[model samples]
Target: MSEQELKLHVPAVARRAVQQDIRQGNASRIRLRALYFDTPGRELARARIALRLRQEGRDWVQTLKMPGADAITRVEINHARPGPVLDLSVYAGTEVEAPLSAIKGELGLCYETDVQRLLRQVRSRHGTIELAYDTGVLRAGTLELPISELEFELMSGRPAAIFAVARRWQQRHGLVLDARSKSERGDALASLARELAALDADDPDAQVRRGTAITRFWAPRGAAAVTLDDTLTPAQAMGRVAAECLDQVARNAAVLAEVDTLGVYPAGQSEHVHQLRVGMRRLRSAWRLFDGWTAPPPATVLQGVRTHFAAFGQSRDQDVLNETVTPVLLQAGMPVITFEAPPVDIDAQAIAAGKAFQGWLLDALEWSLDVQPPSPASAPEPMAASDTAPEPAFRLDGSATAPAITPTIIPLATEAKPQPLHKLLGNRLHRWHAKVAAQGKDFATLDIPARHDLRKRGKRLRYGLSFAESLLPKSRLRGYRKLLSEVQDRLGEINDLAMAKDYYQACVGTHPQAWFALGWISARLDKLIAEAQQAFDRLADTKPFWK
Candidate 1:
């Protein structure tokens, strides 16, 4: 029952298959990959656990799998098509964190099919792409693409070389390298977990598969995803809020408009400015997806919204740098962090700056929305004077003096009307299988802005879903909606912290020579900001907007 003996349990399928292919005239190549695995905190390596999954496969053969644990079940998929083939897997089990000797001592000699070997089979068929293979050795693929690959890394590593190589390969060759490692298959499974939770109350057959497949399951609580449709003319939708739909979208938009106008307001606090920025972002996202039915928001209006947000965002940034960024840079020995402090009149100066920006925003949203003033750069539209559009339902009718009318909330035919989850989490094995296959490349771009954008998008989708959930049987969808709310709240925290941090850094840099000390202060604050951002990013990545 030793580690060496346990390793021998898996059949030598990969070696044997490669040899067979070599003997045949059809053999294309022979590749070897040594994979190392570890838990998030490096616990597996600390405990000396050698966990790996091997793969080998072709069109006619079933995939082979070798799990670290005897009872482990690994689900995998293979794409037979050309260019950017998809292969995915997930491991679910308990962990033993003992020393290497102790781990070896408790190991049992059990045999299972080799899973990693199938990956080789997949490669054999597609011909290896220039992927950073399991051993951390870079191999050039047929297209000579440079790829940054990752295993279940316990600690982050710098993959600068891989990135460089990939960049060259992309420019010289027709292929592109991808840094994204979280497979779509995993996302689908996670989505399935959420969907199955909703079915457990009535589907007895699904009751069995809950914990085994979905992992730690939780129930839902209150209002969830809300979907607002495009009901009015595009012009009307793009116009001011009316008296009709007084739902979340209108509320969000109004809040955004107010936030934009805060620039012109008499007093602009950092907290108020930050909140306004967030409100505008959430509103913009709602408009992006829902604008299909309504008229698209005007470019000038949207740009004005973003501009005011950016200005306040800048002031907020200065605050953050003084509070967060400077400290990190200082700790990391970055000279910019030690820049001198700004003039002692910082508060007075900020007030002036904030007030001026607030005025511009107010003019843009209020006056601009009403009068189609001619721009110095371009002549005004000939019909600008007559460009009147219907207002939002709520605005047109929210007054007590206005005549009351019934609400008309209808689900579009395109919106899938699925049953909401009831209290208990349950199994729906078939439901997992029923999920449609998604293209994996949809989210390969991972950067601060991309993640921020995703947070915005997820918020929009989550809100829309919440609205739709209301129409479902209350007993079923209520709890799930609550869970969604929790997720949104977590995402919101992360996004806010990130925005604050970015703003702070920029502001410090703006006056780096005079405010070196302020930058140092900002750097120190980043630990908290970074922690919040990470916590939220993890949650957002796991619960994508599509879910």
Candidate 2:
């Protein structure tokens, strides 16, 4: 049967409390020992398919698992075995049979896991759920690693039920989401073990510290830019886009949460925070693009996301001011300056993995996947211009630009028939392009809020292109992307300086030295703004890529 499971990593400190909670409930505890198999070429692992023979108490079960329709679901099939022996023929008539039969090389034991499992079933408002807490070790050759995770498998309920339970556990135990499966983690450990053996055999004279090399490198993860299918409906396309965003955000959030243990990321950079924020922004941008095109997320969820986004922005901006901007100012003759601190110095690790933010992401993903057909009379309409559009400048400082074009209002899909995919994408892209390009004309003369909004609009356009790239002509998209990316980068630099300027503008009253910093920022912004305006003006002569 298909299994719907949500896995979360229990923090070190909460394991005892979680165990006590499990004991208080009527739970069945058992010992599970499982052996995983893969071809020498690792075909199954590469394909994200896992085959295993597991011992549950005295009985044996052979199971195969593969990716499912959504992130939370998986195609799992199990057959009772006489003993601890692997069975390949058990999947002959199953949905995963084709992939199993295609493997050319012989399957060999890759890794094994032994864990103490606590299984309990609970019914909530949404549905019935089977909760399993497993704690043990994953072993590959001479290498071994500890495992502590909670898995919620749906017995008879909606998918959202598992998330509701997970959020409760996460809020109470500081649990963070870990999408990587036991098979995936074991595969990684097996690879590491093989590498160490190879190093030792290849050169006896070479110095290799195995202990130092054994530390798990928690790699950074980001979403791949997708080339969407042409046959998908607008709802399907937007759901796919939102799913990718959630995947990126969830993966990076795990890294940030574990940074306390992992110590330092690759290259010693704070990339997790950056990537998490990027994923969140892309999600918000996609929501803006598809607001009227499909069903909308809950208002409370939207506000929660915005609140977290602002918090992250503050942390990122302070990092920029200290790490990127202030050094330049000091080197150019500005003296040391002490700036006022924010009321709460953000605890990035806590915020990234916290229940409130994580819960909103779960809710958002649920909405994206369950997007309903638009209601004819009460369908969601496009956001108002003021919702995302920049304020027009009162006076133009440069050559008179073309009059702003009102965004095209798309018709909502009816129950009988939805809008054409190509037509829908074209209308939205054209509307976004018009709004951003029109405001770019008077960027130099626009006020602070207007400029910031223009930056936001440009960001939406850039992110939208990635989601809609497959529909546009490749040749047209290439050139348009190049200019759009350049325009976006320049606007980003201006935004950074503007943030720094605002900080000092507020500090001048308390710290007189703040004026010197203010002078430096004001001088620097003039040059950056003129440069950004010039780059944006170049966009005027170039035709819209979507055309």
Candidate 3:
């Protein structure tokens, strides 16, 4: 391909402060370039499955691929195009040089003001990947913080096949696709190399160690500058204002255009309908956490978003199953006609319901975004923006005091009272594991939504048990944690699919013709439930990691 493009929506704080120097123009823009290789599949590429890299600028700003067996694709999309040519050609490589040769490609379009365009590019990629690369580009866009991003990739079996793939990729992914060449990960990689070259590492082998330390310690902290009309400090009001601005813009854009694609674009346009669903979740979380601090958004507004999110979520899933999963299963050697009945039909209803739900979501997104604030300056505080600062060193009464927070100490005990870290972890694991197991069992007895809620609670407990194991030493408990995570992931997918199907079915029944189309889709969902059950069984076979 002549050029490949990656659009990344980093948070606004990525911009530098007025105080920082800018010898390389502003860091507001970065450049990147790298070569993607099919590692295991090629002989000249014996390293098999490695994406060779090269780049420019501060090495601290670039990113590195995790060296491993599952490194599927190594992509670099940065703020600037061809930023790495000089560095890649002259500086990169070791005893066995893995240098990259850049192809002639131009930087594509720059959507200077549209954040949603960026997010759409990303979501499109995820959906397309599942469908197998068919000369198409995926797009994900959004208007939320961290800013939204969209990527257009040209996947070709031959090096000379890039341009055709690029052209087709854009049409399939989105019409407005920019042919801009940018590396998402290139700038990070280049920055890292630059630092390594200048490092005073006494031991050559410790390069990785030094790089990690520097990046972790010196990573820039992003902050938004807010000048309040009143005496409140910038910290006190920045996050809230930013979030409110984002919310306003997002709501106005929620009534997704007939042409606008969600997760699985075009074929399954409503796929990202789940965002609205998840937004409802975040909204609910916001209500739970912020209602006492600030009056919550109106109940009608909240209800509208919640209802639509739930509805569209169902339809979106059904669309995916019928359009994506069923085809996948059939391709994977499953007999389509063998498994057909109640669950299948039921799942179809879920699809129709999903469409209806999506309609509601469009309305809710509008409501949430279009909400008129009490006053231009009265938005709630943006908690995340300021949460990273060192905890304030003052007491609530306006007095400065060093309130003591105890450190967790691991005491060394002799053989007589030796406490194994594994044993301690196991004890916590046992408690949390049992709680989750009990919750899972309890879920069966609950009604539809209640059952779903119980499953969610059980899932959280499962994650809690797994987290405990990580904080402890390697032991049988750790194994159990792995098993728990696997089982949780499997069960969660199944339950989500089932619930979505059920919800869709109920909604679609109202539209008879849509119901028939949904019915065909419903058949595929039954298979999904079975697949999820089978996954859970596999998970169950593994002995729990606890001892």
Predicted candidate 2 versus true structure: per-residue lDDT over 1-547, tens digit per residue: 6788888888778889988877777899999999999987899998889889999999999988888887788988888999988878777787777888889999999999999999888778999888899999999999786788999888887988987787787778877787789998899889878867777655654345454455444556765686677588667777888888888888777767772254433322356678878888898888887777677777976897788887766678778888877888788887787655656567777777677877776677667667665555775788886786754544466655555666878699666665566667767888888888788989999998998889888888888888888878889889888888888887887888888888878877887877888888888789888888887887766786564
lDDT of 1 at 439: 14
Residues 425-478, model 3: lDDT tens digits: 345545545555554444434455764665555454453343233434456555
Better of 1 and 2 by TM-score: 2
Give the alpha-carbon lDDT of every model.
0.34, 0.79, 0.36
Task: Encode model 1's per-residue lDDT on 1-547: one tens digit a residue.
Answer: 1110000011122334333432453323323332333333433334433343333333321221222211111222222332223222212121221232242323221112212221111122212222212211211111111112211111112222222332332233222111112221122233443455466676667666654343322111112233223342323322322111112212222223232123433232344444445545545643553343344445665675666556545555466656654555566565653445565433422332233333333233332123222233465666553454333344555654443554769577695443322110111211221221121113233466665555555555544344333233456445544554554555454455556455445655455542444454445445534544444333333422222
RMSD of 2: 12.6
lDDT score of residue 213 within candidate 1? 43
Candidates in order, TM-scores: namely 0.28, 0.79, 0.30
Q: Rank the candidate models, highest TM-score first.
A: 2, 3, 1
- Judging by lDDT, tell me the better candidate of 1 and 3: 3
Model 1 bad stretches (over 4 Å): 1-267, 321-339, 342-449, 462-547
